[model samples]
Target: MIPSRSDWTKALEIRHGKSLNEKFSKSTVAICGLGGLGSNIAISLARAGIGKLILIDFDIVDITNLHRQQYKANQVGEQKTTALSNNLREIAPYISLEIKNTKIDEDNLEELLLGADIVCEAVDVAETKAMIANEVLTHMPDKYLVAASGMAGIGSPNEIITRKITKKLYISGDGVSDVKNSIGLVSPRVMICAAHQALTVLRIIAEEFDL
Candidate 1:
């Protein structure tokens, strides 16, 4: 059944007030990946009632992703964008989303990410994160990015933190872990970092905390 407007956002409206809800409902977020950090951040943003979302990922779901990402076993082999969309739609039936099943690179980053108020850098590799961060942080005046690092393993959950790298760039995680053979991403620590990224995005939207 389609949820009524009141039923859909009753709690959010009560907690955040109408103006904040309106602000969130009018902002757009572009999530550049659908891995553990990106997927969970996207889920939190949808739950927060962001106005629009741009989802981009080139990989297909794999069994290995089940431990860290938001994907399920049944979704294996499906494109990440498609699988994530299916899940987001279930929680927020009317959330606006744009899915791109293509890998992001310097060639098309600016064009593909246009109109986003905030961009969440959820990709795994250090090089890609630095590349995107350099571009978004240096050039975009109105755009902001939340990136993650060192979220692997069941480390101290308290260690997963968000710190402002610049006026427009925020990095989340313990800032030490890497997915080497002996160490790897775990669901709890990864999700904790995802929450930091998601909350940072929301705070950026809220415009309450000075970046």
Candidate 2:
């Protein structure tokens, strides 16, 4: 059986302190893409008791995604948005979740990300990443954007670090590695970058600015 909301947050409150837990429980986060990076980031935030999540992705799980993504082998044919939502609900039943199984473009991106306090860019394509960063920085100035740059290949995990770009934009990763030129994405390095993004979001919610 699922635990009560108060019971569920009681442990998180102990770990995060009541004040921080309250902040986490009141914030809404939006994650774009549900691939390796996005999936790991979503799992981390859900476990942290993020109040609401807007999951946007248009892909379906494939057998290949099992290696680095958060999906199970049995969910290969399922839509990513639905699959991730199911997983998040199992982990944090009381948290609010919003999912969109459609591609986010210049037209609909703003509306999809409307209620989010923070936006996470985890898309694989470089152009898409740039578009998301530009859109959020230009139009949604009030929202914090945590994006990844270079987490591909089997590089040293320590290379993945968060950088504050502007007052509202933060980037995480080595800022050099690209999958097109590298050997490929390794599970650990991708997860390290995802963790950095997740931690940056948490830090923003906690009002812990690194600057």
- Candidate 1, residue 114: how far the Cα is off, in Å: 0.7
Candidate RMSDs in order: 1.5, 0.9
Clashes of 1: 0
Residues 5-100, model 1: lDDT tens digits = 677877678877889998998999999999998899989999999889999999999999998899989999999999999999998887899988
Per-residue lDDT of model 2, residues 115-208, tens digit only? 9999999999888998999999999989999999998899888778899998899999999998889988888998999999999999999999
After TM-score superposition, the amount by which residue 30's alpha carbon in candidate 1 deviates from its true location, in angstroms, is: 0.7
The most accurate candidate by lDDT is 2
- For each candidate, give its TM-score against the true structure: 0.95, 0.98
TM match of model 2 to true structure:
0.98
